[model samples]
Target: MLTDVRKTDRLNLMDQRGLRTSTWNVLTPNAPASKNLLSEELRKNKVSITGLTETRLTGCGEERIGNSDSLLWSGGSTRRNGVDLALNSLARKALLLHEAVSDRLMKARFGHKHGKMTVIVCYAPTSNSGDVTKEDFYSALSRCLATVLPP
Candidate 1:
C-alpha cells in the first residue's frame, strides 16, 4: 500500500480514512542506514514486494542496505547499479549470477522457478564521451539485441 514513494528516501502508506498506514525511511551512505527503519516501514505498510531504480551504485558488494524485515531483496547503489525483487519465498529460491563480458560491461541473470532472465548492465559511452558516432551506437545496440533476437 505505498501511497507515495519518492527519491529523497522516505516512503509513505495511507489508508482511505486519512489514517496512517505505514512509513518507510532509510538513509544511504555517510553511515549505515538503520535496519529498524525499513523493518518498521514494512510492518506498517504490509509491503509484500517492489523494486528500486536509479540506485546509482558503482560497484558490487554483499551488504544489507535496509533492515531485514523491510526488504526482501536489493540491488544497485549510488552509481548506475540497481536491484530487483522477490519476497520471502522468492528469496529462498533466488539465484543472482554475473557474467563479465568486459570491464565496462556485464550481465546479471536471475534464475527462478518461473524461468531464467538477464539484465545486461553496461557502461555504454555517452553522446559526448569522445568522437563516437551514431554508427557506433547502432552497432552496440545491434550486439545487445542479439540476446533477444533471432540469429
Candidate 2:
C-alpha cells in the first residue's frame, strides 16, 4: 500500500530523476492566501508542474503566483467548476501555449528540448449533478483535447 510517507518518498524519487510533476484538487484557489499556501506546498514538494481542479476562480487568464511560479486558470461567473495549471520557473520558461477551454477545463503546453508536453486540468461534474451536465462536461473535455494537436 502507498502510504503518505511512501507517496512523499516516491515523489522525491521522481524529482531526483528529473520528473517533477504533480496534481491537486485545491477546491478553491480564488484567494491570495490560498494561492500562497499552494505555492509554498508546491515549492516544498519540488514540483515543476501541477494541475489544479475546482479552483473556483472566475474569468480566464495567467497570473504569477510567486516570484517563480505562475498559474493559468479558467472559470465561469458562478465561482464554480474551475481548473488551473501551475508552473514553476523552469516550466514557465518552457510554456508555449495555454488555453482556457471552459470553466470545467484548462490546458497548458510546455516545450522542452526533447519535445512538447501538454497538460490538461479538468473538473468533472459530481454525482449530484444531472446527467446532461455530466455529458456536457465530458463533451467539452473531448473537444478541448481534440483541438490540442500534437507538436
Candidate 3:
C-alpha cells in the first residue's frame, strides 16, 4: 500500500480501483522556475490533489501564476514559520483545518468532494543537530497527530 519512487523516471502508477482521488506530497521549492517542472509532471500524471510539506512559503498572499489554487493555512501565531494547504483550485469543499505551532501538530483537511478525502501534512521540528533529538521530535509528532487522526 506504500512505496517510495525514485525521482529520475517521473512515472508513477496509481491504484485507483477503490480510490477516486489522490494526494501527492512533495518537498516544495521557494523558487518560481520550479513550477515549470511540476506543472508538466502534474498535467502528465493527472494528479488530482496535493499535500505539500516543507514548502518554504514566505508569503501568504497566494499570488502564484502557474496554478491558481486557493491555498488555506493555519498560520503559526508568531511570524513567518507555518504551513499552508494549497488545494488545486477545482477542489470544492469547506476545509476543516487547524495548526498548533507551539506544539508538534500542523494539519489541514479537505473533506468530501467528488468522492475525495484530505490528508493531514505536519511539519514537525527537528529537535537538534543530533539523531537523539530528531528521534524525540518524531515521537512527539506521532503522538500529536494521533489525536486528530480518524479512528
Model 1 lDDT tens row, 57-76: 34443334354432322333
In model 3, what lDDT does residue 37 have? 57
Off by over 4 Å in 2: 1-17
TM-score of each prediction = 0.36, 0.84, 0.49
Best by TM-score: 2
* Worst lDDT 10-window in candidate 3: 1-10
Candidate 2 residue-wise lDDT, 17-73, digit = tens = 485888898889867598778888989998888988888888887788876798888
C-alpha lDDT of all candidate models, in order: 0.36, 0.76, 0.44
Candidate 1 residues lying further than 4 Å off, grouped into runs, are 1-60, 69-93, 100-104, 132-151
Candidate 3 local lDDT, 34-135, one digit each (tens): 555554554455544444455555434333425544444333333433454444434423344434332223454444424223355556555544887567
Worst 10 residues of 1 by lDDT: 1-10
- Give the candidates in order of TM-score, highest first: 2, 3, 1
Error of 1 at 40 (Å): 9.9
As for candidate 2, its clashing pairs are none
How many Å off is the CA of 64 in candidate 2?
1.2
